[model samples]
Target: MNRLFDKSIVLACCIAAAVGLAVDARLVAAFCLGVIATSLAEVAQGNRARRASETASYVYIIAAVFVPPFVPLAPLAFYDIARRVRREHAWVALGIGSVFAFALIADLRTDALTARTLLLTAILSVAATLLSLRTAQLEREQQRMRRTRDELQERALALEARNRDLADRQDYEVELATLAERARIAREIHDNVGHQLTRASLQTEALRVVHANEPRIAADFADVKRTVDEALQLVRASVHALNDNAVDLSVQLDCIVEGARSDGGPQVELEALAEHAPANVANCFAAVLREALSNAMRHAHAKTITVRCMEHPSFYQLIVTDDGADATPASSSNVAEGMGLASMRERVEALGGTFTAGPRVGAGGWRVFATVPKPQGDEDR
Candidate 1:
């Protein structure tokens, strides 16, 4: 039964017992019948021991009925004893039966039988009390196990959440690393190979310009060929330096300006503030500066460009200012226009630095400023 039904049944049995006792009727017998019926129902509902022990319980009550003037009390004692026994306690049930039989055969007026019944009742009561204590202990253990299970379930859920969080963080870190590597490789390509190619293209254009009217003068063509060969050798040296992962930024900048001027790219001025600049830092800044200058000449139509490098205590700054025709003169586009600025931003920011490009206030074209940290050993390159 549900809790309410079980409670009501017990309450009804107690009330019946009280009324039967007041009216001098078979009160304990009625109570035993109720307990037996309920216990049997519990067993039929799959509570096995409840119904099985209840049979012995009912027999004990019938025996008690023939025995004493206070016979109802015998069933109450049997109900308590039945609640205590496991299947192996059949001997206890037989002992209860024998006590009830002896009580019935001996007369009530005999002092010996009265004393014996009293002693037997006391022993059964003690056994019931001990079994009740053991049941209480088992109940407490079950409660303890239930609480432990709840705690473990909570911890398991928390650990799962933590693992998910860690996994997400790792994925984000991986993506960031990939983007940084791309930026580094881009900077390498622009500052090294791109500069050399631009120089070669400039010399070829210059040779073509100088020999425009001397189509038949083969000696002047040979002189142009020698200059072309020297430029090629210098380009080769720069390429070699890149393979070794180091290059002189000053030399690279000279080559870039010379090539741009020769090809009529722009009138570009370059400067450096480092008494001892690191090769790696130089290479990165050179890449950024070259891209800026290329953007000014190709798109902005900048005429006079000044590229300045300034050294600070912890960081170095490269500033490229151009006096060029603005792409959007009416209401101009800012640094967000194309991949050139985007690439410059990515290169600087990935190295834990800042990049800002905008129109120079009032005077003319665009300004790009990139600040990069100088590592410890790079103070003198």
Candidate 2:
């Protein structure tokens, strides 16, 4: 809209300069040529077309000197030159000088160098050039402002996203601290109160034996022992639940490998734990891994062991392998079912899973593998 308004001002000035002038065939031809040059300059979009339009406009301006009827179109050439030069003040001055030179040549050729003619031609051309130059400068300033506004908007959005991430991290740290406190309380109850209760129950048992001849006293002591035993069982269950809820699969696996390494045993490595498993699955896998490590170190005299726990979309899998050579199943179809292995197999099968324990196919090591399928609602997990 601004560009159209600017061009309209130049056109109005051109018309004012041509007032009181007579219309003829030359004037109509000049107007048609001016429209053609403006169309090529404004509508076409290439360097070659712009150069062609500029060249044609200059030629038309020079030729119009002979035809006074072409006076209204001459200022359009100067306006276009100002627009092309944009902010180059020196080039705009040079263009105005060329206009005076063209007028002097006109005076040499014909007696058309009247003061009135020179004023209308030179003053109107200057007005059009000034208007075009100022309009170009305003357009460039507007474009720069738009680019700066867009960059600021992008930076604000990035800062907002960073703030959200920081808030989420703070919340996560608080949750971890709460879980750790619960686990610490559970451990304290198990270690301190649980042991005291066991000792009390044992003392009551010895008192019962000592008071066997007194029926009433033996019966009272027996009730006390039963109560103490019940309390101990409850404490153990509470500790187990607290520990299970507090520890995720990654931490449990880490503890398993690290505990084995710290026990003056062989080198143990926890290779991978891809995703978190459910509580029951995690507890089962931890148990299986502990049993496997014990068998490897004690029975097989393994020098190294590796463990992995992976959670798939439909199931959870645990793998334990050790560089042990004391696997004895050659005559029994590789079916050495001991109490530990049987316990591990039963735990897995109870959860609708499969278990395998034997020597590796092409290695001198025992491998224990278990996989438990997810429940119906958790299959997509």
Query: Which structure among the candidates has the greatest TM-score?
Result: 2
Candidate 1, which segments miss by more than 4 Å at Cα? 1-29, 32-117, 213-381
lDDT of 1 at 146: 96
For candidate 1, list the clashing residue pairs, or say none: 302-324
- lDDT (Cα, tens digit) per residue for candidate 1, span 1-381: 232343353344335334323333444554555455545534554456655655655564565546343443443445445444566876866677666656655534564334454554445444443444455566668889998887786566445434544553465466456556655665676587667666766766677677778766545655666776677667566545444433455666667666667465577887866544554566567667766776787668887989788778888888989998655221122334555566567768867889988788888798899898877665553
Model 2: per-residue Cα lDDT over 197-217, one tens digit each: 999999999999999999999
Cα distance off (Å), candidate 2, residue 260:
46
Q: How accurate is candidate 2 locally (lDDT)?
A: 0.74
TM-score of each: 0.33, 0.58
Please give the CA lDDT of all the candidate structures: 0.60, 0.74
Task: Provide the lowest-lDDT 10-residue window in model 2.
Answer: 328-337
The pairs that clash in candidate 2 are none
User: C-alpha displacement of 334 in model 1, angstroms?
Assistant: 49
- Count clashing residue pairs per candidate: 1, 0
